[model samples]
Target: MAYVDSADRGRIRLRRSSLICPGDDTKLLGKMETVAADVCIVDWEDGVVPARKEEARRLTAEALQKAWRCPERVIRTNGMDSDLFETDVFAAVAAGVDSIMLPKVENAEQIIEANLLIDRAEQAAGREAGTVEVWALAETVQSVQNADAIAEVPRVTCLIFGGGDLGADLRLKRIQLGSNRTLGIHRYEYFYAYSRMITAARAAGIDIQVTGFTSYTDLDASREDAEISAQFGATGALAISPRQLPIYNEVFGPGADDLVWADKVLAAVDAAAAEQRAVVVVDGSMVDGPFIRNARFLRSLQDLIDAHDGSVG
Candidate 1:
């Protein structure tokens, strides 16, 4: 479900729920056929163990060649600083993935360098320039700080907020059972990082703003996380399990009440315009520039959902 960017530049994808599958896991990759996520990433980064990196690359490239039900097929490449970086990028590019998730990104120059590599791969593979989009992972504190510059890159279409990695970089305490996640209590710490990335992504006209941290099980907790993420302006979420997909999608999308409100606001605005007025009051609320913008954005999102759902059905 890709749409034109708000900046009137190019296309951006709608990823209400992005399911991450381990690259080396044949079983999981095979099971991807039965899932329904807006984006399915054959992860070559943290999800792949170092011992099986080659296997992951081979499997991911193979997976990309097959037609899957998911609209956006993407891969999360290893860090640019790593030796496997170029290998991962070239393989994914040649495989014709819809997007590349560059993980552990801490600056804009790394993404620029990645685009140079992507350019070479596109030319070598005889693919169109800019066919493959870049999705930057704002995991580190440095990346969060430089998110604006990173989002400004031309081919970059999405900013994946890497809350877990950012927590690790901040030296937050993790669970005792070798989990890299900080204690999930309250989860107020990542609000600042979320704010920085959300603002940067919006400024860059990237529509698919994402929260990239989740775990398996605990459906209640997943719903809470999804609701909180939506409250913070995230349009998408990274799902560790398929069970979380429906929860994320429902949380991020406009509800019946939202559509009702949008209908009323749009009607009010049309009425006011007919009366040659620039503003109108809807149920005691002023329908001005900001109100109109919100109404139109949500209405557009609902339309996208309807079209996509109809197509898939």
Candidate 2:
């Protein structure tokens, strides 16, 4: 476990959907400026071919130079084994990325190395220390086993489930139409892994995100999967296609009914507090410490979304 959080600093960033744009795809990179996803990752790993690694890094740097509408901008660097790994980190940090998505992170040492790399780059660029954060990718069994340790690393803001790669590693067949109907209906077989990471992340007071559901054509399936992730306590979902962004935003966004209930609960709590009462009942349910806390979280989430739209001060 990590140090207890005293403030909202530990609250998860408002990443309803994390969209990955292939670094070498200049067309997709250009479109990033208009995408509505909460976080856009210009990817140098997996999405890019080995021969185009340098080109991809250069493209990502240039894309970061452009004004991005998304609140959070990130770059996913190649794995540690790649010769371009260090350079990718340096370039992404110097390019002023909000965070770096480190692929294939197996342990906390990798996160420490990434943090150190960011430190050097930020210093060399005359930027503040810790300006950039690391989003560690836990896609392998080893990484999942060490999830809690990775969460304890300094500058690690979130742990992302690299489900596609993990599926590959496990040889679990992904969702495909027809013939494999049973497996397709199940879609995901990694809920246990997700729960393990979620438990670890919560213990460390960090955010956890779920990835995979590559069937960009099936918005319905993506929505179902994302809904399951939210139910599993994941803060966000990764989207391989822009088509999935709206689905993630819709599923993760606080609902109207929830907002109404939260508002009522908060007001009732305030009234009770002013009257020196320690408890209250609303909608035939007990409204106490825990309820108040939940209401506050819901209100804060709505406020964040409102702030994003310039609807609130």
Best by TM-score: 2
Q: 145-203, model 2: which lDDT tens digit per residue?
A: 89889987877778898876776777775534222346553444787788899998888
lDDT of all the models against the reference?
0.79, 0.80
**Model 2 misplaced stretches (Cα beyond 4 Å):** 1-9, 171-188, 311-313
Pairs in steric clash, model 1: none
C-alpha TM-scores of all predictions: 0.90, 0.91
Please give the distance, in angstroms, between residue 229's alpha carbon in candidate 2 and its true position after superposition: 0.7
Point to the candidate with the largest lDDT.
2
